[model samples]
Target: MAIEYLGLSQINGPLVVLEGVQNAAFDEIVEMTVNGNEHRLGRVIEIYNNKAIIQVYEGTEGMALRNTHTRLTGHPMEIGVSESMLGRTFNGIGIPIDGLGDIDADKMLDVNGKPLNPVTREYPRNYIRTGLSAIDGLTTLIRGQKLPIFSGNGLPHDQLAAQIVQQASLGDDTDEKFAIVFAAMGVKYDVADFFRRTFEESGVSDHVAMFINLANDPVVERLITPKVALTLAEYLAFERGMHILVILTDMTSFAEAMREVSSSKGEIPSRKGFPGYLYSELATIYERAGIVKGSKGSVTQIPILTMPNDDITHPIPDLTGYITEGQIVLDRLLQGQSVYPPINVLPSLSRLMKDGIGKGFTREDHQDVANQLFSCYAKVGDARALASVIGEDELSPIDKKYLEFGQAFEHQFVGQDLQENRTILETLNIGWKLLGMLPRKELDRIDTKILDQYYQPADRD
Candidate 1:
């Protein structure tokens, strides 16, 4: 259907109220002309009985209410998708940013595409090896899962993201098709530069499609960045039959942008001045990842967000925890100690870990090793805390052994260089070596047959 011209009246802080529009859908694309220049788009957000609230994409700056003309397109915001999108870079709005020529539009997909039906969704059962031992061994990333990485100010979440893009690959040899779509929201120029340099150095830029929204850009642009990136990911994963990994950084920024727009629109505030619909808003993005039954492709997500004041209970991380499968939590304390990954194994978890590890998926001993390690380390942490309160002389010999095991686990097994990508076998071997520091009697979790194959004496030649 052709778009109809709805006269615009009164610009309210980047918002243009449109008259003569009835039943306008949210996220529908509208074009506005200013000073004889026809800007491509605006998005419909709220509608009330023949009147629609539209956010002008190029902003209302230099736009006169009487002079600007508004046309409501029947379609929503969309991105041109094709195999050629790989190896390209786009701005927050899906326009080319890599200095590449305009994209040939073979197909256009709505940014807010429909999600998979509940009954038709397949359980994520395969592993995505990111080569980071802390993740692969402890909080395993299952293919088609929506796992988030929780970090805080001054943490190395960017390095972790780069490592994942550099090393993430499908476990099956038959799946040669894999791609990455990265979206950065409200990031600083230096941070954006670092990502580009890292990708170039790693030589994975060819497989990556990036959409960056800098901090200086209009706050409303950040709101559209992730949706545009995911639109492309869905196209690659479902339409092209390729395994797609979507990496979105600083989701808190995205949420903040939402709050800013909501405030401007006079919506009632929820907790901490955020909109009341924060949970549903985040669900719209996180729920987009999954494997559909009978489709050869899947969309896996790793969304990175910084917890406010290192508080996980903050609305952004809190709401995210409710929607995502699990989180990979970065430890600021460990980072201060110069640990590269700085993953606090205790609080971090992968709810889908059970489906992705052991036997045919990874290795036979994978599950047992992970369980034994977690149990022992947890006990060791308890012993160490007790020792801190009461002197070491008050602890039993077995407790002291556990404390040593916990120390070895963090220093040797959990921590590694940001550039190193250990295979599942290498990660398990490191776990076994740390376990060997304790007496064989403490090895109660693993089967005897598996223990005989992998366990070695700590003092062995």
Candidate 2:
């Protein structure tokens, strides 16, 4: 039997305090009726001796302290999940918004999922080709890896994310189902429409599921978007056996929302006014991406966050770097130089790339090509810096060649057409073509055997 109580002790922003509560559990769902006509739903966020503070999904504006009746639902927040979610769009809290009607759910899953056990995880030994040379050639994304894109405001991160969703694949030949689940929190209406339009125009929306929270929606709902997305992803990858790629854009928005909610709750502030538990909160989300032992599917995450003022030391990106496998940093300098992807390969790397690319996974020369490209690109910076001090005409013949190589590198390798989708082999061959511009002795990163086979000294002529 459930007991319904009358009146709220206090209503603070999106939070409501109910005193004299009995048997109220943390994260338990609650139902509220306003004036006995309008109904609303909420969840228990804080529970103490006999009082519970609930966060209402629907904001509390018209409900008076003495006119609302609250009852605990004895369960945490959950959403009805199904394979039908693919190709659909939803609000922050899992409600459909595409006019396609609600999903025919096969089961309901808790939005706050359990932590995956470390013992049951399988090592990632294959790659997901994103087609962009800066990523596919150097920082190759591996299956079940959590690689984040550290971008800045107004730097075209959204465009890069959309291209990856349109072009990502498991390789040339694979008999497996792959899908993308995209979650956007605190985004404007126009930005949300851009993602939908881009996916539809590219004809890849059939395998994409979008969950969006507009800037005008309730602040509390922004907190639920990623959880609802991951919950559905778990169902699809674990139960239905599909390779799931989850792309979460602008996690900075999510962190700011947490700070706002924590302020409303009167909690102590940590770095940048974010709550102290921000690391644990982020870990719960990033840690969810991996391959389980007994399952035939895997979950890979490409969480994109803009660094505040391009500062990697900021709390959001700082903590993220500690948790994720590696980061793909988008450079403002490269973007200004008209590079499409703008990935600064010197700072960007995939730690798991070595295991995923080799004779069996990608190619025999993949590692050597990646290593030499990185070395040559780093030297490009040195040549430019030296030329700025003492003019390019005063440079040695080798330094002049490096200047030419740098120009070609940023233009052809880092930049690609918006619709261009290059294969892994194509990306690697492009690396060889660029490396051919330099002398044979300059390529110190390549093995002598690999050099004898793939390196052509006369190709530069």
Candidate 3:
């Protein structure tokens, strides 16, 4: 047996230091017999010499150190993995939270699974059609990629996450097969209910699994939520060969939870009083998403977090930007204009987009069209800034046309109903229509041959 019962010598916040044999590994499970009758579970977090520091899973309360006996369970906490996990709701520890009974499965897998090998890593090139033009056209989402969404307070990030879960698809029924693993941390009851209703109404509950750690739950539980979510995702994707999309909403809350736990452990704080290991902690989660070689499945990630005070420079977003492939930025200004997604097309980008859109993937003209649209919109932004100070009347006619393009770009491209899912061709067509408002002489960024083929007649109704 890899366990030994020992009396606790000291209690430090949620951490209980025990004098025992040095046999427990990090994150190993331990059971503490408290007050002779009450039993509590804890995890071995740190080991110094022969002393072990364990974080109580149920919180350390009403326990006397002299009376409590600690026993180490050789293995770490684990959850069952199988097809039955689909459409079910689980807590942070992978226990059923949907009022369903305990899951009975043949095997239990450890929550902290091994990462994919670099030599066996497969390239992620397929597109995940979210039906949002700003994402599809501007920052295309590739299957098995880790793309985070950066939003601000009151920016409808939750709505965007739900829309993706509701509308996300790989391809038609014959070719595409996919599922969603949604994990919400530090959200309110109403928000969780909204997601439940959205999934039920959309008839996707069978293909989507949810693991929620609400705001009122213990802060330490939030630290385990994403790991639990990814564990199931890996099981479904790598083992079952199913394309899985893992959506984690409000990662900032997760970081805050980490900060709280670190504070409880008396660790040094980083920026904004967060833990110093915040970046590495986030990487452990983000790096779990990808395509494994010799497997037909892939795990794509879309982690959403609100920037505190709309500050992208904040540690959470700043660190996230470095770890993930790219980010989709939501604009409060566009939200004020009543745009549904409020995606700021300029700042948003997908680094893996080049591999996902081309002749074999999307279309031959996809790259050129996207570039031209970006260039024209950038010019429009410059024109609008000038017009704000110099007045539209003082600007040249060419600059005035750009100002009009900017207005049409946001209204026609960025703005769309959350329910609408436009095809790739339709999204490209919309871009062409918006560009048609400009004079033909100003179309320098696009090739004349492609322009002749795609450019709609400005006078066409």
Candidate 4:
């Protein structure tokens, strides 16, 4: 039996408030009947005493106070998932929109299911290659690790996300089926279409599942998009035993949606007008990724969020850095130079990079080479700053060499074709070749034996 209410006390934005409600649980699904026959869906978000606040998923556009009927389903909202979800497209709420019929569901899962126990989580050790030298050679992404990309508006984060979906693979080529669950929150139509075409053109659509919430869709739906995408990823990873990659693009939109709902509900605001519980709310989504103990499959997350005004300390990126393992930062300065990925190595870091590379994983010199590059690049920055004050001709010989090394590093190493996929060996060799531009003493960060083996100087004509 269900509890039905004749009229709502208030309809504010996407929320409908009903008074004197009894036994109504939070997150319980509600069916609202409007104009005698039309149906709208919502979920109870908050309850105080006898008043229940429901967030309408389909928008409360035509909702009427006197005639509408609110019936509680007595359960939290769930998504029907099945193995057939691969190669399909769904709306933000998980309804099939590819003109495909409903999935013959294997099970139904609460979108807000509990996260994996900390005790059952295995340390993420293996590397996931995105094929871009900027990420692979420098800020490496580790399997089962949550690494977020911090980009700004008008940047190419979407292109980078799409490229990763097209190119990311396991260290071992024979690993199990690698699948992508991509969720686009409040993006434009062209942006969503671009991802679809890129997947199809790369022949990787068969390995991808997409959930889209466009800019004009109900704002409340944006809040559900990533959760729905992650739910599908959990099904594919743990149940079907497949390696899964979940990419949520523009999480800023998701956060904005939360802010909007909070404001509508008259909740107090915290930093930059976002709700106070924003950090924990984001964790509910980002923390869902990882390898469970004894499971053959793992879930890796690459959450891409645009920093407002390119501000890294903004609430969205600031809180994200605390929760995620590391961040891949995109620079507008490099974008102005026409860089494809525009990943600024100075601020970008992967804390788990050391764990994922070296010995049998990538290469023995991987860590040292990475260290030397950062050291040299830091010097290059100093040399450029000095040259700006005094002309390049007035600089010391070593300083000039650092200048030359900087350009070579960016053009030859950081700047790579968007479609080009380099093997780990090829990427490392390119790093060594760039390092050879400078004299042997500049390679102090690298071990002596390893440098002797890989760092021979390029013959200057």
Find the 10 residues in a row with the least total lDDT in model 1: 1-10
lDDT of each: 0.87, 0.91, 0.87, 0.91
Tens digit per residue, CA lDDT, model 4, 42-110: 999999999999999988888878878989888888999987898999999999999978899999998
Candidate 3 or 1, higher TM-score: 1
Indicate the residue-level lDDT of 398 in model 2. 90
Q: How would you encode candidate 3's per-residue C-alpha lDDT over 162-263 as one tens digit per residue?
A: 999998888553375689999999999999999999999989999998998888776677877898889889988988889999999889999988887899
Once model 1 is optimally superposed onto the true structure by TM-score, how far is the C-alpha of residue 419 displaced, in angstroms?
A: 1.5
Query: Candidate 2: TM-score?
Result: 0.97
Kindly report which residue pairs in candidate 4 clash with one another.
none
- Model 3, 407: alpha-carbon shift in Å? 1.5
C-alpha root-mean-square deviation, candidate 1:
1.9
Candidate 1 lDDT over 113-209, as tens digits, reads: 8867899999998888899888999999998999999999999998889889999998646545989999999999999999999998989999999
Q: Supply candidate 2's per-residue lDDT for 444.
A: 99
Q: List residue ranges in candidate 2 displaced over 4 A.
A: 35-37, 458-461
